[model samples]
Target chain A: MDCSFENEIHLEQLMPLIEEYLAQGKPVKFSPRGISMLPMLRQGVDSVILESYKGVPRKYDIPLYRRDDGCFVLHRVVKVGKTYTCIGDNQFNLEHGIRHDQIIAIVTGFYRGTKYYSVNNMGYLLYSRIWHCSRGIRHFCGRCLAGIRRRLR
Target chain B: MKIKDGYIVREVAGTTVVLPTGDDLDLTKMIKLNDTGKFLWQELQQDTDEDRLVAALLREYSVDEATARAGVQRFVNKLKDNGLLI
Candidate 1:
């Protein structure tokens, strides 16, 4: 049945429910509303499957971590050491000093339309590596593309 | 027929919603059910057919057999269309 919500539910309010399900070993799937993980994940279009992370997040792994401001960010781990540094695929700024406790879950896979792409897929791994390596250039090109789109509008 | 696995029924913001989880995560569409629909869905969790559903509706509501049958048919059709029934 075509169900529409008259009011939007905030992510903070939904996190507890999501956690409860995950605690029961159930994977939570929902359409993430953001433009941060662009190219790989489209806003309001792609849906992701989030499962409770078992171990420490490694570099190139996209983990959903809660920030000190209480906002959950699904970003790629760029560096792993005493602290994890995460940066969105579509952004230039890197988020540093994230601890393991702040991380909620890691993305197992995601659905693009009806097709499912696992995080461990060879092509996805290659793309993530390349994307992570060329963040500066991608950021510049993304800005240029956005400017062009705005001008066109 | 039975309601498939990997679907969770939750009450979100005063709305009863059926969301696909696990392997069915690709299903982006959320199904919202009313009080009656929710009850019927719970019943359908076990093995049930249209006649049994219609009978349950008759037992619960004061509707006639024909009306109950039609309602059950419509509900079953909606679930089938959404690939919710197995």
Candidate 2:
């Protein structure tokens, strides 16, 4: 007989704190959305635990958003400025600039598929790089697909 | 917005982008876009109507009046046909 250990993170277990950091800019949860965080996080599936992002976030780092519509958006931080600017990795340009105080957390980890990984560690930067460098082209393709998706139905 | 010159567009991370061509979307089977197609997509996001969109494309891409008008019409028709337009 053998015994093994594995770590599991659950969404119900994660939501309260995520709500906290996110709304108050205190302890936050940076849930994954869309394909921008791809190769790192999955769309509509992956999620992360975030703390109050205190320092400046670097280019290619993912940031949690409280959008103008009061909806939260999670996208990549593409430029470091007095007001941080983020865009989806496959986007044409930075969608909006947020005050530093508005950011909930810089994504420190990712959950791809069923496995959990640390963005602070190795093997993750490569994924981030591909998303950043290829953003423009990726957005182009995605927009094309959006058109196609509409047509197919 | 029209795509900048010398680069094609692609989608990554759910956002439309303009990069070198040839990168195919490999994640989901749906929601993919090419460069010129992305330029058209951006225009839809803006407040401009179809005629303004055609004019803008002509200025940016520097195509002849007929070509730009035709491209914009095709893209807008596709958008309407697909129910993306109101």
Candidate 3:
């Protein structure tokens, strides 16, 4: 079946619908747009499976959270405290003071092309750890790569 | 007729998206409805019949009775074909 739509829904509106589905104890799957969670997730390419989070998010776990500005961000937890500090995988800055109630769901898995990678998968786990550790180096490499791609263009 | 259970309508961008919830997630079908289709779908949700739906379309939109009837028939048929009608 053809299962696609060309609608650009706001995060505020979509969150309620996603929460409703998760409230029913069902995983919600949808393609997220943005370059924030780069490398791991691609805009218009990857689809994520989200389940309602139960406890505090650990370091390196990606959670879908809402900011005070009513914007939803799917970013990795960098620090866990009374309030979690998060940073997008592709971002250089850290977003601090995210509350527990602000977290809507945790990404359990994601589909890249036809292959599905679970958060529990050993390869994904290893990659997550390595990616988190090497952010500085990756950031530099990403800039270099972008320059090269621009030159090619 | 009513829209079947497990289906939720959302407005995305400027388009209407009908998403199936719960176990119906596997359906993976994101149905996009036009303005008229969205109006009709909302009417269907409130214990509406084909006649009432046509009346609503005629009342809300600047369409003639014949056009409204034909539009309602086409819309209902499309919903039936997609197994969205109950």
What does candidate 3's lDDT look like per residue over B1-86, in tens digits? Answer: 88888888876556578877647253235677777888888888877898998888878888788878878888887788878889
TM-score (0 to 1) of chain B for each candidate? 0.88, 0.61, 0.89
Q: Would you estimate the TM-scores of all the predictions?
A: 0.65, 0.45, 0.68
**Clash pairs, model 3 backbone:** A8-B13
Q: How many Å off is the CA of A7 in candidate 2? A: 20
Show pairs that collide, candidate 1.
none
Instruction: Write the residue-wise lDDT of candidate 3 on A71-102 in tens digits.
Output: 88899999999999999877888899999999
Candidate 1 lDDT, tens digit per residue, B1-86?
Answer: 99998778887666676776654333246666777788789888999999998888888888888877877887888788778899
Question: What docking grade applies to model 2?
Answer: incorrect
> For each candidate, what is the lDDT?
0.80, 0.57, 0.80
Q: Report the CAPRI category for model 3.
A: incorrect
For model 3, the stretches where C-alpha displacement exceeds 4 angstroms are: A1-6, A141-153, B1-16, B21-28, B32-34, B39-60, B63-86
The runs of at least 3 residues in candidate 1 whose Cα sits more than 4 Å from the true structure, single-residue gaps closed, are A1-9, A141-153, B1-8, B12-16, B20-86
Q: State iRMS for model 3.
A: 7.3
Q: After superposition, how far is residue B70 of candidate 1 from its true place, in Å?
A: 19
Q: What is the Cα-based lDDT of residue B18 in candidate 2?
A: 31
